[model samples]
Target: MRSKIYNAPCERESVRLLRFAAATAALSALAVLAPATASALPAEKKPSPSVVDVHDSELTDKQIRDFWTPERVKEALRNPAKAPATRAARSRTATSPSPSPDLAASAPARGFAADAARSGANTAAGLSVSQEVPAGAGNNIVGKLIYVSPTGELTHCSAASIVSANKNTIWTAGHCVHEGDGSGEAGWSKYVMYYPGYSRGADPVGEWTAARLHAPTAWTQDGDAYEADIAAVVLNPRLDGNLEDVVGYAFGYLFTENRTDYAGAAVMGYPAEGYQRSDLDGERLMYCAGDTTDAFPLNPFDDRIKLDCDMGRGVSGGAFVWGPQNDPRIVGAASHVALDDAGQRVSDDLFSSEHGSYAAALINTVNNEG
Candidate 1:
């Protein structure tokens, strides 16, 4: 087993440990997203994230306290440092063209912003993919998860379905369930679980417990920590709702089917505030680009899966669908961040691939559980 580092909230002046995690790494993932500072800095300038003043609105300690009620305070206490350590270089399990060594050498290993610096921060593109509905009832898809510490604190992440209502499973990153390689798995984290379509932290349907949490064991064991950082939860109580019975299923892609033509795709799901991730389904539907690409050290060889979709804190596990055309389907998902040669961090994309068998396996797990 690898040594796990846990993060607390940002109760201090600086951004608390936003994982880029599970960046468990909003900040952690973005460590690589920002333009690299090492080479950019005057050789003598201290090599670190430049704290340029920005009109950024982070959660107030009071707000966090109120949002989480009692548990958040304890998490705040555990994470005392202004920042944790991010990898000097992003780590990747598979191969894309080798990144400019300049970018490779300076990736932040681990630190705050593990959520890759999130805030309803969303980016996406305009594309199209195929999706299907499971006929009848409510065939909607959604993401779900739980945050717990050894101290017994809890929170939640969100998710969405791309496969229409055919199955009762939801697709999301692995970290959403177990805290992935970096933080969520720390001893401080008790049990990490997910619930689909859970709004306001409550299950709109019957509150179903995870019969099983399925993900790439590699990510679970760090095979390609960030690459195969995907997972799915098998709902113990199958989805009783269907398309006709409910609203409708969100469109998405085929399992493990790669659609490189996804230049403009739509990503949707419940966000931090929960529910459709928007007050009016409009904001909830995030559209990104197919030409999305930057240099991220962690998962270097990305095959063009990047976007700029807006999602708040609660929107962790959502679907990166490929469009509003006829039937849009999911192509990729918001996994983590990447660093360029300059050490700038940016959001990344995660899709099914050679090392992505685990992702499909997870999907199977959900099918079996259902």
Candidate 2:
């Protein structure tokens, strides 16, 4: 798994890879171990008025595409934890220095994207069996996300396409776009590279690049804020056309708090464990379908959904879908892994931040600007 802190001066250790048993997997892995509820936000409130908007990368579309070659992507998958992009969690009271007047004065207004209509009826109630996406697949909107961190190390995660007026908005865990390091030390990710329907080291519809990032202040300020872990990325269209025109599918999502208990969903990602267990080198997409439960005590809040899926590392930013994996709407995006009683990172029972005002605002920001 990626280290919880990014760019820290620490040696990395090898984490064992774990995969879900196709027939034996069940929803019994849900466990809420931690109980620090002090920072939990009320679920009914709107997103915070202030958000962190970042578009500071210097790499252009061509530069990013050229930098992240197939060889680099393979190397990153081989050593998944070598250089995690996660930011270390600091005390909640830690504060960041203010931006210069030029930056603060020119910041855009806080925005919101109307929750798109939910698509496809909720169906099935079982664990999501791990499946590999095929090459040349049509209507596939979910795929691998690759990028270079500020330290210049190649990093990656999973992301899903979302329906938007711009038709270029994508969603994933906040840490996927920005290092989750506590305030001041963190910033937007650089050299953003995305490959939708990437299977077996192949870019099915070619790669896309990120133009901007919209994330909740909670995550930007506190790396441990799992409830606020989701982020929305606006992409620069490909040379051929817009993202939707190429993939031909983008999902809608729900922002209300009512979708938590729904069991008809699938959490999909390009799990590194799958690569370790086989010869694919983490290039295949895997998912675990099941109902979402409260990750409360362990997560210390209601903002995250707990599932029994056993995905690892590279899957951090994968989507939690409400219907079919290909053309489904989303309710959450996977963020962090839970720790066992022994304080060891556990692969099963992953948590995802639920879609809310923070997500809506991210979508809006991208639509208005991207």
Q: In model 2, which residue pairs have backbone atoms overlapping below 3 Å?
A: 5-86, 5-88, 6-86, 34-297, 34-298, 87-181, 128-288, 128-289
Off by over 4 Å in 1: 1-140, 149-153, 162-166, 182-206, 223-226, 238-252, 255-261, 270-301, 310-313, 323-326, 338-356, 368-370
TM of each candidate vs. truth: 0.48, 0.71
| lDDT for each candidate structure | 0.33, 0.54
Q: How many angstroms is residue 309 displaced in model 1 relative to the true structure, after the best TM-score fit? A: 3.1
Deviation in angstroms for 145 in model 1? 3.1
Cα RMSD for candidates in order: 17.9, 11.2
The superposed Cα distance between candidate 1 and the true structure at residue 19, in angstroms, equals: 32
Give the alpha carbon lDDT tens digit for every residue of 1-370 in model 1.
1111111100000111111101101111212232221111111111111110011112232332245434552352222111122221226552222211121011111111112344322232222121111121221244344544334445544455433123334555554554334432342222333333443334444333443455554444342432344455443333565321232343334333122333343444433221122342211222223432222324334332344443333334455543223333444455433334553332223222211223434443333332
Which residue runs of candidate 2 sit more than 4 Å off their true CA positions? 1-49, 81-125, 133-139, 183-186, 274-280, 297-300, 324-327, 341-343
